[model samples]
Target: MGNNKSLRDMQAEVDQYISQFKEGYFSPLAMLARLSEELGELSREVNHFYGEKPKKSSEKENTVEEELADMLFVVICFANSLNIDLQKAHDAVMHKFNTRDKDRWTRIGEEGEDENGNN
Candidate 1:
């Protein structure tokens, strides 16, 4: 959810930010560990908001969107270090989903109306 930039553009921005640092991207293992940590943070937020669990008064609150952005930054760093194009990766997965699950779910308008209660 960056404004309007493509994934490639986002990758370039991440690269520029990382380039300023003396130590660039972390090792792959470290990147994975960081991703896991961010994911856990996001999960905790989700649990507090939507699940039975409640956040403790001492705990700080973070939006799910912010946690997702943090994870995305780490992922972009990982992909940039490996010279992988996330746009291509995302497209390939979307292609698979479109082909393999073309009819797996019903469309909102297929039932003669949109999900928004519109005609």
Candidate 2:
């Protein structure tokens, strides 16, 4: 959560995570499917939030948060298997945008506009 760590560090953490699993309980394809299911759950929350779909009757249930965490867990597990540092990957994309497309998505604060100011 603080900063990028080496692949070795990520690998060690992944090894510890795998230690808790029973042998051959799941496969890569299964993990991907699980990830997809989590994404679908998250999408439902987005739909409800945007009024494109009705909110569930169990409003107290935090399905969205749980789904998001589920998606992240699988994503990190996938990246760990592929020997990718999620933080490093994230930073690389951010750097690319900062260097190459800094102005591609201009916003009011930078555009010298209060065009839609909510004040």
Clashes of each: 0, 0
Model 1 poorest ten-residue lDDT run: 108-117
Model 1 Cα lDDT, one tens digit per residue, 1-119:
36899999999999999999999899999999999999999899889888999889999888888988998999999999899999999999999889998666777657755555467
Model 1 — TM-score against the truth?
Answer: 0.84
Give residue 11's error in model 1 in angstroms. 0.5
lDDT of 1: 0.90
Q: How accurate is candidate 2 locally (lDDT)?
A: 0.70
TM-score of each: 0.84, 0.66
Clashing pairs in 2: none
- Residue 80, candidate 1: Cα error in Å is 0.8
